[model samples]
Target: MPDPIRDADPTIAAAVESERERQESTLGMIASENHVSEAVLTAQGTALTNKYAEGYPGARYYGGCEHVDEVERTAIERAKSLWGADHVNVQPHSGTQANMGVYFAALEPGETILSLDLTHGGHLSHGHHVNFSGQLYEVEQYEVDPKTGYIDYDALAERARAVDPAMIVSGSSAYPREFDWERIGEIADAVDAFHLADIAHITGLVAAGVHSSPAEHADFVTGSTHKTIRSGRGGIIMCDEAYADDVDSAVFPGSQGGPLMHNVAGKAVGFGEALEPAFEEYASRTVENASALAAVLRDRGLSLVSGGTDKHLVLVDLRESHPDLTGDDAEAALSDVGIVLNKNTVPGETRSPFVTSGIRIGTSALTTRGFGPEEIETVAHHIADVLDAPDDDATLERVSESVDDLCESFPVYG
Candidate 1:
């Protein structure tokens, strides 16, 4: 079949084809990315994109919204079932915006927000000084125990007492360990603060029961639909019914206008797919592959933060094993060989954020492409080979060829 986009606009059509080819050819190891299914892709490209449903289902500001209302209702119901939440709002454009919605609903401007430090695997929306959360609210940060690469709950409790923040944010972008959500919630309660668990990177894992959920522990939970969940590209907020109206209004008239109805349809489709038993198997395999990759990297004498991972990503700190190799250089070398990951700042990062001391690699995309433990171990060796001698032309060419062969063996789309 011919592509309609090619007939309508050749330039954008070429870029889209190139991107699809790129994903098929390369290994996507970025911890925050994954490939959505064809059903989800089709849903996002539907005529629902032309609608403007400015309010909730059955109560929209527009008149011709009956079909979109059904889609939005399905998305909300599936999200609630998937995460066991009492209320869900699937309107925020991104995970960061989801956090904004919570902040707007719960805290007044200039109130304090205590969260994990960015260099220690926290996100920008979790009170990084440059973000709106940091600008509008006074931000206090906590860090992992540098010696053990784990969060110190005792220290966090103490800091919460001192800061007396309005909200406490839990979850991370690159941290390889699971959070003690109940304990964090207890601390938040003790401090009289709302707990916001930003599980942007582990939504599918949580839904699949491969990771502990914060839904029961935190006051609010937020996640990106596109990461491990492989849903549409948007954000979702989950809360108890007590705060449903506040959250809904904050997401609608307070921060954003009409919701992206096409993305909501995609979310509905993807969430429906996730409710199947196969998604649990996929989520379990993703974690297992990540563990295998971690073991191989450690055997190769590479140092992993926290000594290992319980999720889909491993954070490799090069300060000890490869002190001279910066994360930027390692990322470039890996990219040259068709492995796509990102540079990341470690717990005690000394270098700048752009050229950090560590790299974060994930197995979600490869796992989606059907890579198992054996394949993941092989890829781990390739990573070590390139990082061991990043400048060797002969090694680069050999690894590039090997990567091409592997990508051919495990095609993303067929």
Candidate 2:
């Protein structure tokens, strides 16, 4: 290990050590998070953060930007190469900001827009009344089929045609199926609206060729570097040449001022890492683990939305098998035994979004930690035990032991 940074900044260094201990001890089952390499962490703590390169590479508002320009340019090139995008803007700060930049470039305030319903797996920026997208624009929502628990393209098209929105946002925060990017683009074209695909959760899948790439079909695409990509917390926007200037302007002067060079450097490392041969196998294993986990739940007589998952996440319907348990209770119960997941709404859920009827599980964190299909199934069985008998001391104890044993086999950051 390198020398402890504690010698320089004891305050932050202590916090870092505490976080490291937390990670070493806990099981991370969150769908939206992943562990990054030490190299990525080092890039984030570099001296690049001290500079004020408030503008793009050469066209900076300050001096001493020769080296920082290379960092930003390398990030931009790697992004473009990864997705084959004509234009790449690597300064949005987050996936939400990437979505916002696209929206700001394409739509004016008060314009009608088509987006997915929040409770049905859509992101907050897609049109939640509390989000800026909703506060500034008129939103028309579309929902999935009540029984199928999958995206209803026919209904989405109907709503898009009815609303005649200026833009159509396609993506989700908790959706577990592959997106029909071409169908979404067709709908956007039929309604004469701009289409943006928010592939934040599936960016790694796209990069690794495990899922459909929206960059090839949509007018614009946005993604995050932290999720399945196993990078830092950052956002990126990819667009065609026709919209390059507008998109770049929207990201820079129109939205944020200076880009986070350290984060961008980390993004470059992640992009470089993704291009390696091993990343494809890692991503494929992630999907396989998700499917394997889902199979265990179904075999145990638990209902899974859409029957099962096609990617790295599964939505288990608590209303069916565990009728007495609410999503909130199940989440807390599972957490008690060291398992983690977010409570989410199913298509036909009668409960509110806050107190949802389902829990969303992903295998990204576990897959990155080196768990394969067999291990994933074992963990899934343990999760079922924890959920079915949260109050049983023996059951919780057994499940906790299983979790510890599994993490022990695949120790993180050791």
Candidate 3:
């Protein structure tokens, strides 16, 4: 088969070829990644890339942007329409940069922020000491309820009251349940702080109405255009009209130079797809598959963090199921059989993140590839079956064969 990427960029054709081969050969189960439509891929390589529009449409720093003006405007309007935001900035290169714009627009360099702990599902941009957001700001951490393995709304508010943060952040990377966004909003109000919702992982689901929309309760909502949105790689910050100017400026001269017009075009296409009714079905089914897999795992007496999943990902605690197997080992075992998944830290992880006691499995990709509850169940059983007897190359081979069978039934990237 002829790969379009080959003809498009022969300079990087080898890299593209290798990446496509990897995708075709294995399951991409990472919650944060998704397979965008070929239409999206095409849009991302449009002729709009030749322009250098450093400013907003109609207010550019350079000329020859007449066509790009419509592109930028379309992207802005579609993103705003999809999310119901008073203002939208689809210029950030990625989620982290989108977060940077929010921080720049809303805070002084040394202000304080109270957010969920990174290990507890919070993004690094929320304030891990290693990230720029943490280095420039004071960060207070919150945790999930130990017993429930989910955010403790009450505890969060208590911490907000004590820290008196300049901002309160809500969202998680590995969290399996819906968050109390309204409660977080109330906490921000009580503390007279701005509320920023990092819905990067759930943006698609939220846009499709399968998950709660933070735009209603948050002052600033940041998300990636990919994930559930299944767009290209980029970030968006949606907010009220009150901060639009600051937000736009922060993204342009403040954080990035020229907006990647190709990425913006892809975002526009993705936003359009999200506005479709079928997108809702995709989002819902993604969650359903996650839940189904969690059930099968739990039914086999394996303890799942938070008991089960309410979203498209599950954090399976391995302490009981694979007594001696670290998350790293299980991840390798699954990979050996083409059942790709990432090892992640559970709350109060028993070991380091690199060798944790849990695996984080997400169903957005598999579901998008057309796997439903039945296939998810098959995947769950095969994972448990193989990991139960790790080092059994025979079981790994069998699982790999089954994976290929399911994948063949629903062709990916065809």
The TM-scores of all predictions, comma-separated, are 0.99, 0.97, 0.96
Q: Candidate 1 or 2, higher TM-score?
A: 1
Model 3 agreement with the true structure over 338-398: per-residue lDDT tens digits: 8888988888886987798888999998888888899899899998897788888788788
The most accurate candidate by TM-score is 1
Clashes of each: 0, 0, 0
The TM-score between candidate 1 and the true structure equals 0.99
Mind giving the per-residue lDDT tens digits that candidate 1 earns over 286-314? 99999999999999999999999999999
Q: Which window of 10 residues has the lowest lDDT sum in candidate 1?
A: 126-135
Stretches of candidate 3 exceeding 4 Å from the true structure: 1-11
Q: State each model's C-alpha RMSD to the native.
A: 0.7, 1.5, 1.7
lDDT to native, each model: 0.96, 0.87, 0.88
Model 1, global lDDT: 0.96
User: Cα miss at 413, model 3 (Å)?
Assistant: 1.6
Of candidates 3 and 2, the better by lDDT: 3
Give stretches of model 2 more than 4 Å off.
1-12
**Which of the numbered candidates is closest to the native, going by highest lDDT?**
1
